[model samples]
Target: MEGKTCCVTGHRDLPQKEINHVKAALRREIDSAVADGFTRFMSGFADGVDQYFAEIVLEKKKTNPALELIAVIPYQKRLDSLMAKGRTYEMLEACADVVVMQEKCHPSVYSHRNRYMVEHSDRVIAVYDGREKGGTVRAIRFAHQFRKELREIPVGLILDKNRTNLGQNRI
Candidate 1:
């Protein structure tokens, strides 16, 4: 599925009010990607957007078992450091493949993982709020540099439907 793979990147902490909208957007993108003949979805397994992306991909996999969820972990220690280890572990257990980018944490480990994902993926789906910084921005820049197809979920756009009480809950 080299040519059919898509990787996701997003913020680790989303605004509490926009969580539901981000999730809905992610679901829509994943469905659209699947419909377009994409089968393998890659995730960084980070807290907010990455976990949400992985969750939605797994839900899609229920109906289409051919869909594969790949975890591109930045470092071996990342799992241990995450606050939502239980949820992350569950996602890891369900993933079709997991690639630990680094055995130890370093300043560039996460960037390396992001580069790896962008390099291997034919398309990139990003949940970005138009922020000029952070890993999501770097990933998006890499996607441009590599000339990958990019579909973005506009986090900065505040829709009335997106304003809800869905606080900081994990799916």
Candidate 2:
């Protein structure tokens, strides 16, 4: 679990339709990784795609005893704010075997969190829409800088193919 580490990064908002597609892709990638003896998965546990990835990894961890989910928490206060919204955060937190809580919660907390994940991981499972200059892009870039193997679930692939939402809506 320590050596075979992968991280998840993605936008905070995404359409439900696109989410389902990403979920399927994620399941395939994660399960394949498991078969290859890659057991550790780190997630920021942010809203939308991050949470989805965490949940899926947790589910896999249930039957696969070797699988471990590590929550790279940026700040406890921000996590508390998200937890106040509902039980999803609690569920994710419960599943994580290791919670890496960062000490500082500054304006650049998320960027710092992304750096931590990228630096710690051997690979990255990125879910990006490719429509914005967002945190997801920055994290992917950082992973690239470290030469981590990236497996992307590009939401823009689906959105752009349909060309329905244009750029008005983003995930």
Candidate 3:
């Protein structure tokens, strides 16, 4: 899985209007990765982009048995929170492996999980706005340091599309 794995990182709270566009981009990127021989996809199991990645991978797994979804959970508390979401719980149930990085929550647990994912993955698919400084940014930086192949779906692209649509509506 070391050389054939792809990990995903992104913002947890996405603009509701951009969900479809983001999903489309994710599907395209995932398909491209499959074409490039990536079989295992890992997700941090966060709310927005991570959930979308897990759901897409699970859906693809139904048609392609070779594809695997690995859930890299940061801590026990975070896992509990995710389990409360029925969709995420179902996703977890369908995962090939669930790795709990920490038993208790720590300041560095999320970063640790991000590092672990990048370390094990050959590529990274990031849904970033290119401005916010958070876990997503840190994960992308790790990808660069580790020299992993990166495919970014910019949030700003979706925002620009919305603006264009708004402008056209006024015409």
Candidate 4:
């Protein structure tokens, strides 16, 4: 429930072809954060990359029992909104060490959730496609404004020379 916390944010509709590569990059970023003494990971419990990030945190806890997974649920009906995104809603709720529910749900509930996470976290690990809009873009911008250490994985250009395949996935 304490120590350095990293919040996760990303798009819901990630391209299928980049799933593996993006996940790899996210895992690496998370591992590096752990090495830097991040003991807790926070997720919005949304679809796509948020779910993936939460899964990685849970998996990492198997080896590092001290690590914690926290779900920052925005409003009471947040799960209902997230339910369409596979079993992430149930999984995160069941596995999270701490689940913080907001007072109410509003039209801008997700924005509130993102703000809460960014405000509390010391760092942010976001999978962004650089589309110039959407919640992912907003979260990344918010993180920068809050001066949180950000590790952004460009899932859009999953095949770009500089970012793709980690150390080496050359053609």
Best by TM-score: 3
lDDT of each: 0.87, 0.80, 0.92, 0.80
lDDT of 2 by residue, 39-135 (tens): 8888888888888888888888778767788877788776677667666656656654545466657888888889989998888988888855878
Question: How many residue pairs of model 3 clash at the backbone?
Answer: 0
Worst 10 residues of 1 by lDDT: 161-170
By descending TM-score, how would the candidates be arranged? 3, 1, 2, 4
Per-residue alpha-carbon lDDT of model 1 for 1-171, expressed as tens digits? Answer: 553999999998888987998999999888889888899999998889998999999988888899999999898778666425777778788899888888899999989999999999988999887677789999999999999999988785433324433442432
Worst 10 residues of 2 by lDDT: 92-101
Model 4 is weakest, by summed lDDT over 10 consecutive residues, at 157-166
Q: In candidate 4, residue 111 scores what lDDT?
A: 82
Give the runs in model 1 whose Cα sits over 4 Å from its true position: 81-84, 157-171
What's the CA error at residue 18 for candidate 4, in Å?
0.9
TM-score of 2: 0.83
lDDT of 3 by residue, 39-143 (tens): 999999988999999999999999999999999999999889888988888999999999999999999999999999998999999998765578999999999
Q: Top lDDT: which candidate number? A: 3
Q: List runs of model 4 lying over 4 Å from the truth.
A: 80-86, 93-104, 157-171
Steric clash count of candidate 4 = 0
Candidate with more favorable, higher TM-score: 2 or 4: 2
For each candidate in turn, the TM-score is 0.87, 0.83, 0.89, 0.82
Comparing 2 and 3 on TM-score, the stronger one = 3
